[model samples]
Target: MSEQADLKRTPLWDAHRRLGARMVPFGGWDMPVQYATGILAEAKAVRTTAGLFDVSHMGRLEVHGPTAREALESLTPNVIGKLALKKGHYTLFLNERGGVIDDLIVYCQEPNLYKLIVNASNTEKDCAWIQSHLPAGSVLTNRTPDTALLALQGPLAVTIMAAAGAPEASEIRRFERVAVRLFNNPAWAMRTGYTGEDGFEIQCSATSAENLWNALLRVAGPNLVPCGLGARDVLRIEAAYPLYGHEIDDDCNPWEAGLGWVLKKTEGFIGAEALARLKESQARQLVGLTMETRSVARQGATVLAGDRPCGEVVSGTFSPNVNASIALAYVDRDVTDETLTVESGGRRQNAARTPLPFVDLPVARKKKPAGLTSTASL
Candidate 1:
């Protein structure tokens, strides 16, 4: 079969094409890399205003049955039992060696039930791995086929969402999910996003995707830009959010990846023993790098401390928000030099150690009601 025919199309694929998006192959799916407004414009819209993203290419899996909680806790490092109803948490699925299988967000919908949003490329592999570890009375179901996800991100995201039909989205605390009417259709809205901005990741039926997309655009008018993967990548890179293949993989552990914060305590989970054995001295830690110029470093770029190669860049780009080049790299723990050099495509750019986030964005888009506590506060 032709490669194009083999690539999966999202429910809103036609909508994206109609908006003059540049289609590209990503994770075995035909996705848009950028719209005609270009990556910079789309990213600016997201940072300064709002942008809507059709993220249907991601995988959604449902874990049901009585043993769901027990089975899930065994596969990840986070304590799954602590998730309250309608609440979710970001976590990593780990192997016995403490390597990350994937990083995902798990939401508790009911007793013994969970909805996991995994990376698009790792859907099948993650499913198989989870199934192998699941004990009796636990069940796993792939819900990607019937689900469509829309991420409306930026500082103005909540305002735009309320104007688009989901006023209750403003009240949804970070990490909390609620049922809402979006574009006059029933859907679930989660106050979670990857861009380090206030936003909502709305889950709706695949059948309603196109109509909802159109309605959101019409209601948002000129305020909301339809962003593509290019802008999405830039936004996430600026936020220092890890991508599956670049910043994280099966061989990368939480300690080395700067993901130790996800674990409340490391004793009861699958990789607990392995994680407990990890020490700071033995870890190759992830760090943020700010380049002196606009010279962007690509993944696999060698990071040098003086003349010696000490690490490799995992993700990098020219951050529009910062108006300069930035990157994330895994540097050897023994290297204490504040000044480093990143060599990419044979070009060496001087860099300095920067904090994790290149841009400081809001964690909570809107204030919660008096009784609700934000996940950001935790």
Candidate 2:
């Protein structure tokens, strides 16, 4: 079999090929890494107007039963007790030692139904972990093979979505979702995305993905272009969004990843004791680094504090939005707020510890329209 045949393909594989995308293997799946326009162009398009991403490879799973919420709470850091119906929260699945298994987005789609969007590579592991910890009456279903995921991101995404038969797009607020009809098909439209922009993630059937994609293309026209994983990585890094296996992984805990806020000590959950201890001990910390030069520091690059090794770069990329070389790394808490040197491509570049989200979104906390209230129904 050809190398390409050995890799799994999403439903939009033909669409990406038709658009002349540069296909690559990502998380064991044949995915488009970029288009002919390049990552730089794709990033700019999303920041300025809108961009469409075929993220169908991401894992989608369902947890249902009377004890679903309790089961999920036992596995993730987010307080599931506080989640309202149809509301979503960003959470992390942690190991017994307080290390992150995967960062995920969980949505309480209904009173007893919960939906989880996990990293593509860790789908099986995440599902197994949840099932193993689930209560006796709870049930877990992996729907990744049947679901299609798409992200429409940018300042103008709402306009494009509204025009493409998603009139209720104007009613969904951030971290909220609604069951809506698109192109005469049912879809779960959520006001959330990886890019630090106003956007929506549309989930539907694999059979309906192509039709909706084409319809979105027709409506977005020149303003929205099809992007791929390469651009997604750069844009997410610019926004300071953590990536699984990069900014966080099985060996990294929430305290060291700058995600301590998500852990509510009062709420008894898995890894609570270990997390509390880590917070009190103050061992390591996650910090952002900006390079003095344009030479990018890549993952696994050695980070030096003066003459000694201090840490390793986890996620590093050439940020198209900031026009700088940026990275996220873990360093000793005491070593934070200090200057360091990074070895990239056999050259040493000066770097300094900076705050998370090197590039801030101007209106991250802006209020949505009145019609976008949480209680609004489609």
Top candidate, metric TM-score: 1
Candidate 2 structure quality by residue, lDDT tens digits, 275-350 = 8677677577777899999888889998888878888898888888888889988777778546899986788989
lDDT of 1 by residue, 2-32 (tens): 8989999999999998999999999989999
Pairs that collide, model 2: none
What value of lDDT does candidate 2 attain over all alpha carbons?
0.86
Candidate 1 C-alpha RMSD relative to the actual structure:
3.1
Candidate 1 regions off by >4 Å? 364-378
Q: How far out, in Å, is residue 104 in model 2?
A: 0.8
Tell me the lDDT of model 2 at 188: 85
Span of 10 residues, lowest total lDDT, candidate 2: 369-378
Worst 10 residues of 1 by lDDT: 364-373
Candidate 1 residue 349 C-alpha distance from true site, Å: 1.7
